[model samples]
Every structure is written in structure tokens, then in C-alpha cells.
Target: MRKDVVPVSSPSPLPPLSPPAGPPPCPPARRVSLPAARPVRLVLCLSPVLLAGCWALADRPVASEGASRLAAADPGWLLAGAALTCLTWVAAACVRQGSLPDKLPPGLLLASQFAAGAANHVLPGGLGAHAVTLRFLRARGVPLDRATASIGLYSLARSVTRTLVLLAFLAACPARRRLGELVPDGPVPVPAAAVAGGALAVAGVLLTVVPPVRRPVTGLVRAALADARAVHGRPCRVLALWGGSAAMPLVQAGTLVCVGTSLGLGLPWEQVVLAHLAAGTAVGAVPAPGGLAVDAALVWTLVSFGAVPAVAAATVIGHRVLNDWLPLLPGALTLSALIRARAL
Candidate 1:
């Protein structure tokens, strides 16, 4: 009908918006069952009882006497001994730091070491500190297996170095005698010492050799020969670590000598070193916190072998005060810092 052609502009179709993906599947919503709350209630009720027992132990006659004596020990000797211990820990930290692929900060690692040491003194069983150290390393991305292997290797290296140093000391003073009175006719043979030395040698050799372990054991041997070349591939650093580790025992033995001299026990350095090593090794097997009972027993046994009764007791007591308690304050503080920092 001749209507004028009109142009119709239809509206453009709108694009549909898809719904946003839901919260990434909610991660399967792991169901975590926390520990029952009963133990917390029990602890709240019994805490006072536990504290009372601690007080009782602290109030014991022997504990009181020891505390008094510890308070009265020479400040200089205590400071010097503490300094040596700090040096030992530093060496340990250095070795650990050197072994890592991504080396941890030196300060943090040292803090962890000190914290671990403090824990070793307070916690039951010998592995407390080591466990803390492993956890610390694990948190920092070191695989558990590798961390354990590294720590074990470092400990072995330290022990080997210590043994070698002790042996060298013995060799240098072969004629040394115990604290017992001189025999009118001749010296009594110390069969016990000889047996101990022989046993140590055998155990050390067996542990160092053998297959499967032969790999790591071989590493130790090559490291020793090339001076840690096989381990870190840097002989000088490895040798330095070993040498530093050896110095710890030497300084420790020297502390014993100082104790003997101060207490007028007149115990020979060689005799003391032998006894010290034996006692240290034996007591280390004990599970008590810091090997407290074990350490006391070791000192008593070592000193009693030849020392005059009173002097021996005094030396033992004095050594504990000078060596153990004095550094505990700083060690504990360091440990606390580590925990607070979550470095260990």
C-alpha cells in the first residue's frame, strides 16, 4: 500500500553473566578433632600439687647445701668456664650452618642451638634439644630426612674429633698416674682404664665401618683424611669445624683440672681426662633432664677412684656449680628467646 519504508532498530541481545565459581570447592573441609578437654581440667586441678613437689625437691638438704656452695664459687672461674661453653655452642652452630643448602641466618641458628641446649637441661631424655633443632630446620624448608642426616653427621664428626683429641692427650701423658697413693714397690696396673680404651676403640671402628652405613661412614673416613673434603668439599672449613669441636672436650677437661687444683685434690690431668670422658659418656646415656643425676654420679665415681674423700666431694660439687649452673641463666634466656622467636 505504498507505505513509506520505515527502518526498525531492534535492541541488541544482552550477554548472559555466568555465576562465579563457589569458593574453590571449599578444600574438602577437613574435620579436625581436637584433644578432649578433660586433661586441661585435670591439669588445672593438679598444678598446685605438682608445684608443691617441685618445691619439696628444691628444699632438700643436699640441694640447699649445693646451692649455697654454688653461690660461693669463684666468679672468675665460672665466667671463664661459661665462656668456653658458649664457644663450643658457637662451633656447633657453625658446623650446622655450613651444612645447609640454603644456610639459615647465623643468628637464628645460634639461637636455636642455645634454646636446644637449655631444653636438654630441663627436658627429660637426651633427644629434647635435638628434636627441637630438627623441627626448627624442618620449618625452614629442610627435609626431615636430610636434617636428621646432617645433624647425625655433624655429631659423628664432633665425636670423632673429640675422641682423637682425648687419645692424643693420653698419648702425651702416658706416664700419668691416678690420685691414689704411690705404691711402695710399684704402680698398680689400671686394667680398667686399658679395657675402657680398648672398648672405645672397638665401638668407634665398628660404627665407622660397615655397608649401607658404609656410604656415610665412608664419607666420614674420607672427610677425616681429606679433612672434610668429601663432606662439604671444602677441606679447610670441615677441618676447622672438627678442630673447633675437639677444643670443647679439651676445655671441658681443663675445667676439671681447674676444679681439682682449686679444691686441692691434686688429681693428674690425664687421670681426670680419662675419668671425665668415661663419666661423660656413661652419664650421657641417662634420660634425666640435662643428665643431672648422671652427671653427679659420674663426678662422684671419677673423683672417688683415687681422690681424698672430702676433696673429691668438694671438687665434684664445685665443678657442677662452676660449669653447669653458672651458664644456665644465659642459656635459659637464650632458649626462651628462641621459643618466643619460633626459631626453635
Candidate 2:
């Protein structure tokens, strides 16, 4: 008995699955938690403050004395010294630009130098400043070799100029006789020179023995020579290099002179200049950072020149405040800003 089977149509085949309307929803964006990122940024932001604070606290007594003396100093002369201090950075920028054949943005170059001054005080042997400059050059697309060569040239020119300046002042200074008294009657200088020569010789031998070291050093020498030739060929660059270098010591002396005058330090401006130049030259070979050794030498020299001990101390302190301490915070801020902008 065939049951009246109603024509049972097979269930309509399901419509073919169509692809979801858009590209497969990207796997829920991975939530990457950088636990250290915030802390890194915080550290970077606070580094300058911490450094300045620690430096100030390290010499709290000296800093306090300097601050009090500066407060008592002639504001007009202090202002002049401050102005001269600013010019030193300008001179530095010119020297840096003249060292390289390529042109750096004047504003940024000046800014970098301003920032470098702050860094110079923090690290030994000017490492901090050099590091900042190297980073700046790299960011500006300068070749590493050329950048390094420029630094070497800058240092060499500055040293030569400083020596020439010291000699010139010595020849012209009326206090030359007094300065001669400061030199020890011994073979001290001879040994120092011999040691320096031996160090160079040992370094040369090591470079010669190590292929890897030799190659890079040789390349650097070649690059330096080429850059020097290129830079010297241009009259403006030559003037800027030598002239700016020479100006550095002169301006620094001027700053000291102004500060000394402001604080009633009993010394002629010329004597002060001579003292500063001589003291710096004498102690420059010392590796103490931030010219600490030079500062001590300067204080001693000033005393020898018949300045009152307290006044001489105050003078040096004021000079340091005008040159180093005053600009530190601003320079640090500039440095931080540059880092943020990726210009350093």
C-alpha cells in the first residue's frame, strides 16, 4: 500500500557560504604591553635634573659660597661676563663648522654647541660633548669617518691655537718673570713628554700589529688628511677654524677678567689673562673633567699674582658660575629637546 507520499522535496540546498564582506578581521590587534617604555621615558625626562642636582649637591659648600659671592658681585660686570660666555659657544660653533667641509644648519650647530657645554661638564675628557656631536653629525647624514676626522681636526686646531695664545701672552705679559717662578726646577716636563711619546709609540705598534685596528686607523688618517686639505682650501673655513679657536681662549680670559673685576679681586686684567692662560696650559694635560685641575691652578696663580685669597676664590667661583653653572640648566634643556626632536 503506497502511502500517499506527499512529494517531499529535498530541503533546498543551503546557499553556498559567501566570504565575509571584508578582509578577515585582523586578529584582535595584539595588545603589546611595553612595561619598560614609560619608565624609560621618565628616566630620560628626569636625567638632566638629576645630574644637575647631584653636581650641585656634591659641592654644596662651594656652590653656596659661589652663590653668595655672585649675589654680592657687580651685576653689570657679571652680565658682561655672561655675554662673553655666550660668545664662546658661538665661537665653538664656528670652529665646529669650519672643521667639516659640509655645511651644518647654523641654528642647530649653535644649539648643539650650547647643549654640548652642559654635557662637557658631566663627563671626563670631553667625552659627553664629543658623543653629542657625533650623534648630531650622524643624524645630519655625515659619514662616520668624516665626522670623526672633523672632531680630530677640531681638537688639534684648538690645542695649537691655545698653545700659540699662551706663548703670545707670555711674551707680552709684564708678569712673565712671576710666571717663570711657578715652573719647577726639575726634569718633570721631560718625563711627561717622554711618557706621552712612549704612549703614542706603543699605540702605533699595536695598530701595526693588528690588521683590523690598522685598517680603520689608516682609513681615518686618510680621511682626516683629505678633510683637512679640503677645509684649508677654503679661506672662510681657514679663518673660522683658526680664528675661532684663538678667540676661545681670549673670550674665556675676558670672562674671567670681568668676573674678577666685578668681585674686587686685586689684579690687572692683563695679569688675570696671563694667569688664566698659563694655568690652563699648565694643567690642560691633566685628565680631570670640567677643568677642575685648571680651576685649582688658576686659583693658585691668581694668589701668586697678589690677589687676596678670599677675593681670588670668589673671582674664580664667580667666573665658574658665569660660564659653567649658569648655562647648565638651559643647555641641558636644549639637549633634551634635541633628543626628543631626533636632531641630536
In candidate 2, which residue pairs get closer than 3 Å at backbone N, Cα or C atoms, i.e. clash? none
lDDT of 2 by residue, 36-136 (tens): 89789767856766787788788778778899999988999999999999999999999999999998999999999999987877887777788889989
Candidate with maximal lDDT? 2
Q: What's the residue-level lDDT of 293 in candidate 1? A: 66
- Per-residue lDDT for 50 in model 2? 74
Prediction 2 TM-score vs. true: 0.89
After superposition, the stretches of candidate 2 with alpha carbons farther than 4 Å from their true spots are 1-35
TM-score of each: 0.64, 0.89
Q: Write the per-residue lDDT of candidate 1 for residues 103-191, one digit (tens) a residue.
A: 57777887777656655654666475678688888878876556776667667766777677656655675433442222234433477
- List the pairs of residues colliding in candidate 1: 223-228
